[model samples]
Target: MLAKAFYPTEYKKQKENSWIRVCVRFLLLITLGVPSNTLGSFQITDDISKLSVLKQNIPRDYNISVSYVPKELAGMCWVKLNIYYLEESLNELAKKFGNVSSNKNDIKILIDMLQDMRLPLGHLDPIMYDFECHFRNEQWQTEQYFDYVKDLLKAAEDNISDDCDPPPCPTTLPTGKGFDVI
Candidate 1:
């Protein structure tokens, strides 16, 4: 038909170019987004600055620097996180996720992984927590958020591989969908 006749070669080239662009975009997001903000950078809970809770879950290594940027929290949210991690390079530890999966269950796997690392509370009954860590509405946009998660996973992965103290049980770890705990 028309596809096979006039534009066959041009059409094919166009398709190939489109595919290349998509891949480049994905890589760009994954590379730039993944390391600095997507996966490995450390993320203190959005509300970690809330006195008691911040004290409760202080990281063993890096300190969380809270910028009281109420005005620019929105204007500078993503940019700030990006710049912060860019300087620290904490994003180097994170694994960037591509487009979200259609499957809810797959999403659950990431949530489960977070719990196993003790970043989140044990998963059980209700999603609410006596104490829980949560992302701000804008957090998902930053590379730092995922990086924090990556750091915890890196620890748990090392722990499980080393047979050290038999990584905490799921219920004990308290992480999953619709659940939170301190």
Candidate 2:
């Protein structure tokens, strides 16, 4: 007589099983302590940590020559390496999310994390300035050296733009920039 009587027992069993599956999934999520809303943030945080590690591994004594690449370039190189890793991580996140622009809040969180990480590197500004001055004067040694310097300069510019307001900037190296070769 009731609507329930119209459905077969098999249909009712399937409905109950689906509800059980949903409940199990919800419980698992809660037990894992990963709130659904903060999952993206956790992924972003993990990526930032990995970037920090990569930045730390850059050789502090990295120098080409006393006359060409100064010892100060080591710090600048670290900054460049950081930017490159950050860009790669962001790209991977973008791919995972598929159209990250729509998720403005996630983008903001990522940018905030990046800015915080870069805060300590602010002290390197004087070194960067000296590099820029030398760059403008064509003081670098070879064509490869000049391209490498340009790549570093491009990375620096990308870093500055990323620290600005919303909409994370694109990281573009100069034409001949080699990956990790510097």
Candidate 3:
């Protein structure tokens, strides 16, 4: 019975190095003492606050302004309004007035907005997208949601160490090594 209970099929399958990596990440998280939920807090706040600024900048009657949208329905319109906000910010920066120096503040805000936009392009998207699909389904399943949460945890763990390095280009080869065929 003990041998049967300890069988490989009954155990969680993971790469040999995976537990070491998990321990290191777990220790790193503990050492930092930062709650996992707060990982994207700053970026999320920056994204939300930009809406108010964009709302204030655009005229109330402006066609693309989301100011008129109800707060309850905001999620439905968020992505569209975010794109419009970027465009409107760029347009504002492009214009020059008699007195005001073409709002450097707007340019800074735009840069932050672009960074916020790029944040979602990180590796967590596929897991989040899967979660989204499950969330949208008419049938609710607790087991699936639990699995989604686990996947999300793993994705967050995987992404926690990402330093956001730029991709290799024709001009730049990766720094590590060249393979030698035996």
Task: Write the candidate numbers in order of decreasing TM-score.
Answer: 3, 2, 1
What is the C-alpha local distance difference test score of each model? 0.34, 0.40, 0.37
RMSD of 2: 15.5
| Clash totals for all candidate models | 22, 0, 0
Off by over 4 Å in 1: 1-104, 116-140, 160-182
Measured with C-alpha atoms, the lDDT of residue 48 in candidate 3 is 34
Candidate 3 clashes between residue pairs 3 or more apart in a chain or in different chains:
none
| Model 2: lowest-lDDT 10 consecutive positions | 161-170
Ranking by lDDT: 2, 3, 1
Backbone clash pairs for candidate 2 read none
How much is the lDDT of residue 65 in candidate 1? 30
TM-score of each: 0.21, 0.25, 0.25
Q: Score residue 74 of candidate 1 by CA lDDT.
A: 20
Instruction: Between candidates 1 and 3, name the one with more favorable lDDT.
Output: 3
lDDT of 1 at 67: 23
Candidate 1 weakest lDDT stretch, 10 residues = 128-137
